[model samples]
Target: MHGKIPMASYDEAVASKLRRVSTDSLRFGIIALIAFLTLVDLFAAQAILPSLVVKFSVSRATMGFAVNASTFGMAIAGVAVALLGRNIDRRNGIWFSLVVLAIPTALLSITDSIAMFALLRVLQGLCMSAAFTLTIAYLAEHFSPGQAAGALAAYVTGNVASNFFGRILSAAVADGFGISINFLTFAALNIAGALLVWLTLKKTDRMMRIDADHPPVGGAWKAHFKNRELRGSFAIGFLILFVFIGTFTYVNFQLAAAPLALSPMALGLVYFVFLPSMLTTPLAGRVARRFGPANGIVLTLGIAIAGLLALLTPNLPIVLAGMALIAIGTFLAQAIATGHVSRVAARDKAAASGIYLASYYSGGLVGSFVLGQVYDRLGWTTCVVVLVAALIAATIIARPLTAPRV
Candidate 1:
């Protein structure tokens, strides 16, 4: 009878904990909402580029400058946040960045000149990147290593959701109401997300304050880089997004040409294959906890490689099936790598995450700019070959993560 009583009490306790688990959802939703607001513009711009070119009487190449500008800004902001803004409170950093993001995003609606629009995009990128970097570092620092894996998975899931839905939503708005309305609507959402962050996510984790009190900016990098495993994490981080951005960037061009010419709406729907990553990414944390981060990464990258190979065939269903696999693998790899950074960096966790993200966004910048030309000159097959090689290199770089020390 007493054993039965204890078992009942234990079950009740578990139920109580499950109720509190809803808070994680709240926090995840707020962070995800903010990410969605900022990233929607990034993906949506691709769909709206033709409208932009027509509106400004500019060349397609010139219209691309805005995206490139934002990518550059994100890279610079990531570095700056890592090095210069080490002491900023995480909550306040996010709050400030959100408010700043709202201004530029709103300004984007009213800006007439292409140069001015590009400038606003750069500003928005700076603020958005800072917000994202800080939120990731905050999530990593607050949770236990195993739990951090889950938290980071949710975070990346939010990012994947943004990638899938943001583009679709933004493109729809632009199609229905014109480009200005799209920017204005996104700007309003940014402000609302900022308010939610400020009101609900009010307190910073105390551990973060303790961790931030470490070596100077350069020394912090030196400390993280000194760890061989962390360095591999950074490299893997760079390469994961490098291939992701590169593939998606050029696939649009490929789909728009030849026998498989697809409309803009169809292109956006093609990205829907990535929607599964919202499921696959969160599961990544569980995979890492069970299989170890190293093995999880290798498995996911292998899947990505296979997906890229599938693209070599000219069939649309086969190509899309390949893309879905690539998206799943990329998100899983990123979630594992991102969570591993938080686990492995013994100190200056923010710096570690910041540098990792800096590497990530830099990969995006380089892949889009450099590989766009690669596609233009060498064609889709060559681009796919380059991405496959890069994924293999990422798998090699991530091998150290399997070591006992890691």
Candidate 2:
């Protein structure tokens, strides 16, 4: 009897072709550009935080609010975009959002009032939220599952690289000109990103179209809440980010003062912690593929907790070491968790992503405020304590992952 070729061979052949198609597509380039812009916005704000505090004579608590404002705006916009569903042309929506995002970023260059700056930051957050959600959704729609993970990881690498370079650039510019100029530089970057997307991204009819049969548009939110795995993942995301933001937000202050006494340039170099993410993100996908995403999440969270404890040692080398550990662990966790959500919620990918991201950013917002207060009231040690508590909570949530749904 003649033997037949295995099904796996056909799948591998199809996957290889799709990968080639995806890599050559203009959509991938646009997505990567958007990802780069996201990081620029994030670091530009962070790099200038210390300067802003000194200029306005604002307390850490107030600064926390300003920093968290971006996330708050993002969370709101995510919900709104998800609820709107596939009715809108995602490409146009993303482009429009970028234009909106650039406005507030540029406005930072002109405004001297703290109140105005804070308001602008919030608008930037909203625009960012929409842009990110739409871009990811577009990618998921266009690429096959096997190709999507690599593409997503590439997008994330753009984010990590941007954080690294954006911080360095902002710090250098601030040292030469001023913090305001740093904001302008990022604004220009965003404008350039928008132009790139406009020129490159192909307009397609792939947008999600909601109709009468899909009458349960509003029900998607409620439906996502019903997902136990998704809820657990969101909780962990919120807690982890809360601590992550809180720690990074006040770290410059800590370094600038006391034993470290690092200048802005020196402190900016600490952002090298982001570099490992470029590697860990792809590795995370492999780990998730082999051992399952839930297991990868738990493992990463444990590593993060250990990293947080390492920072408690009070040695400069130990602190940097700890930061590196946290960065690796957090990135791994995010990569796995994001991929898990996409895989699990195959039908409502965009809505699921929006919800998960909302949780992720909302955690940043709440963490900034709560930890800022902890820092003010009890000091850095207390801030660490809050992060430890959040880590413990993540561990508890992660425990359920052990017997995860197949």
Candidate 3:
């Protein structure tokens, strides 16, 4: 009887362990889906930039600025969230922002005026940034210490997957149906994302309470700026996105024009370049752990620089190789830097996320305008030069972008 009882207890314990493993897997899957939906819209539009340029009858620079105006809104919203995030409900804010994001996404289907298009993009950005900022804070609050690293790695992997699939989805939908259909499809995705978060995420009141003892959020920001490692991370984030926007945005025009006039379907297929990055990004934590964060970033930057230089070639296969290399390198670097920020910001992680995201997206905003103008005037060759230089500069900054020393 005693032996039977012990076996029963052992079996019951095994069942419990299995149940826990299943729950954690399910949780990580949900996190990855949420991350994918949250960021899909950010770069998807670039896939169809040529069509928009023709439809709007605008210059490439003007169209680039208008399409990328969302980044400016993200930059602004990041700062706002950084300053006021301590008072927010992470889960509720995330779902609500995603719900609002759908509205502007739907409106894009009908907008004909370039100005209105840009405005909608800005509004979309604001909602996306709000949701994004809150989602990061949500994960931090909800996950355990053991789960946090895996959860974050899943999120970053989702981010990279979104880059690949979002552009493909955008291009295929726009080509198969129409541009209007593309925006509407994305609008549906935004709502679906809202539903996912609303349904799966539980309300956790883990926000830092602002009593008399806590310093003001503004003071926190001031201190963040003063931290050398944080500053270096911010710089690397800015430069990475700057180079990314320059390469992907203008490269679309290059492919859509003259010698290599890839169809929308083909352009979408080309974003398969992001596949390698998606595979590599989830390993970022492992890489950083093995080689150290700064060394990892420097190594990745070297890959990106090599890729940037390869884009100077007029050959289609070589250009695609460059894109793949760039995608892999930048994504690995971004993932490592993101993890570093989350670790190093010991005091105000939410506030740090906001400022870091702001700097990151601001680079996209600036790069869109600056590199678009460069592409419009100086051509793809000169634009590649600028991108390579930015990557080189990022390598320099990445040396100090590691976690803060204890």
Assess every candidate by TM-score.
Answer: 0.86, 0.89, 0.94
lDDT scores in order: 0.77, 0.76, 0.88
Model 2 clashing residue pairs (backbone) = 86-208
Clashes of each: 0, 1, 0
| RMSD after CA superposition, every candidate | 3.2, 4.7, 2.0
Error of 1 at 35 (Å): 3.7
Residues 197-265, candidate 2, lDDT per residue (tens digit)? Answer: 677666768776433454375576567678787788788778877877887787767777778877777
Error of 2 at 77 (Å): 1.2
Worst 10 residues of 2 by lDDT: 209-218
Pitting candidate 1 against candidate 2, the one with the higher lDDT is 1
lDDT value for candidate 1?
A: 0.77
Candidate number achieving the greatest lDDT relative to the actual structure: 3
Q: Compared with the true structure, what per-residue lDDT tens digits does model 3 show for residues 125-169?
A: 999888887787677667787888788778887888888999999
Ranking by TM-score: 3, 2, 1
Q: Candidate 3: where are CA atoms >4 Å away?
A: 1-14, 208-212, 401-403
Q: Candidate 1 versus the native: TM-score?
A: 0.86
TM-score, cand. 2: 0.89
Clashes of 1: 0
